[model samples]
Target: ARDGILVVRPDSGELPKIVLDVLESLAGKFGTSNTPTGHKLLPPKIRVIQGDGIDINSLEMILKTMTAAGWAADNLAFGSGGALLQKLHRDTQKCAFKCSYAVVNGEGVDVVKDPITDPGKKSKKGRLSLEKNADGTWSTITEGKGDPAKDQLVRIFLNGDLTVDEKFQTIRDRSNVGL
Candidate 1:
């Protein structure tokens, strides 16, 4: 037991209440010390992991309850597995990819999907290109008016051939430019 901390995971029961109860029980058995914030900290040998039914809302509630009960946030950790991804669907963010523009017979054709039943589902029309403005912000140019030379969207594939093959780390670094 001295080699590592023992993580006690409570998988069932009401999260906020159960977490507080477990902390209280652990404090009674293994004891605790007070933090600078006047919150109780579990001994170095033990901690609690609350993994079930965990979502943003429940996590916030549990933290608030623990803080109110004089327990430090360090006494507990969280695991968000199914609650992190299982509850999500495409409609959650209103995300979809449709053919906005296509070229056939050497002519540009604009394709749009705007269902009268759901105006929010309206899609963009005409050829689209991403442009970085002078303010360092990005905007999509529509109706095929964007200058192809300045477009940030690189053609990665063309006619069964790979055009631009970029390393994953390069793309990740580019995505983190402003942040």
Candidate 2:
């Protein structure tokens, strides 16, 4: 029990689970998973533990991962909300929304609202708030629901629904900042 930072067992085999736990707890912090085996790459994966009641940033990371993996992702407006999605990856490819957001949700993430601007005659009224679902579907939770996540999906589902994905994409493709 006394070898300083490097202690060796003097007798019998050791239970490895203790060692594994320590590593995983730390790994979970830096965009990785804490599997029983050890730290694992968790890119493009989603893990929501409502049981433990974790915060949104972590949940958002998982959602971001899912989107990057080309999977449908939705975060109920009441769900994961804090994000700073860069027009493009800070390290990898750059990304930017094609439209001028009345509100910037977080980095690449878009938390769109209905009635982008008052219809002139009014100040602000009758806006819709759309929520993204894990199934890659969207439903209005409020008056403004033009979330980036819904762009392509609504085209096929709602038919009459118009999305701003391309408009935002165009801005991203051109702007010095994918604003």
Top candidate on TM-score is 1
**Predicted structure with the largest lDDT when compared to the true one:** 1
The global C-alpha lDDT for each of the candidates, from Candidate 1 onward, is: 0.84, 0.34
Query: Clash number for model 2?
Result: 30
Q: Each model's TM-score?
A: 0.48, 0.15
**Could you tell me how far off, in angstroms, the CA of residue 71 lies in candidate 1 after the best superposition?**
0.6
Q: Model 1, stretches more than 4 Å misplaced? A: 88-179
lDDT of 2 by residue, 1-179 (tens): 44333211111112122222322343365355333534353332322222111245544554455445433332111222123343233213322222322333543333432322223212222334456567755464433446655533233223357454566667577655323
Q: What is the per-residue lDDT of model 1 for residues 1-179, given as tens digits with 9 covering 90 to 100?
A: 35988999863566698899889989999999999989999998899999877889999999999998889999999987666668764446867788897788988798988754467778888878989988889888974588777799877877679999889999999999988
Q: List the residue pairs that clash in candidate 1.
A: none
Could you give me the TM-score of model 1 versus the true structure? 0.48
